[model samples]
Target: MKFGARNQITATVGTVKTGDVMSQIDLQVDHPHGMSSVMTTESLQELGIKPGDKVRVIVKAIHVLVAKE
Candidate 1:
């Protein structure tokens, strides 16, 4: 898949918090400060993301996205 976002970084999944409709995923990047991504639970499931998994963090504007691939 292709993304318009150019700011990408490799990060480890720190935490996965899922609710009924949405989910929040914490990321551990190289930087001292961490990051988080909020996506739908369905999308989270589709990615099969879990704590300690490696993922790509995509940043565009004020939004954060995660890709398991």
Candidate 2:
């Protein structure tokens, strides 16, 4: 996959919190600070994200995206 965001991190999924419309994903990264991302619940389902999964964390100026491959 081609991502314009240069800042990427390899992280493990720590938690997934799903609301009615959106879901929040917490990740365990190697960096000092914590990292998390939010997306629609539908997207979460499509990705099949769960705790302990390894994901690619994409960091842009205004958003943090989680990609499961």
TM-score of each: 0.80, 0.80
lDDT of 2 at 29: 91
Top candidate, metric lDDT? 1
Off by over 4 Å in 1: 61-69
lDDT of each: 0.91, 0.89
What tens-digit string does per-residue lDDT give for candidate 1 at 1-69?
A: 667886888999998999999999999999899999999999999999999999988777556455796
Candidate 1 lDDT for residue 32: 98
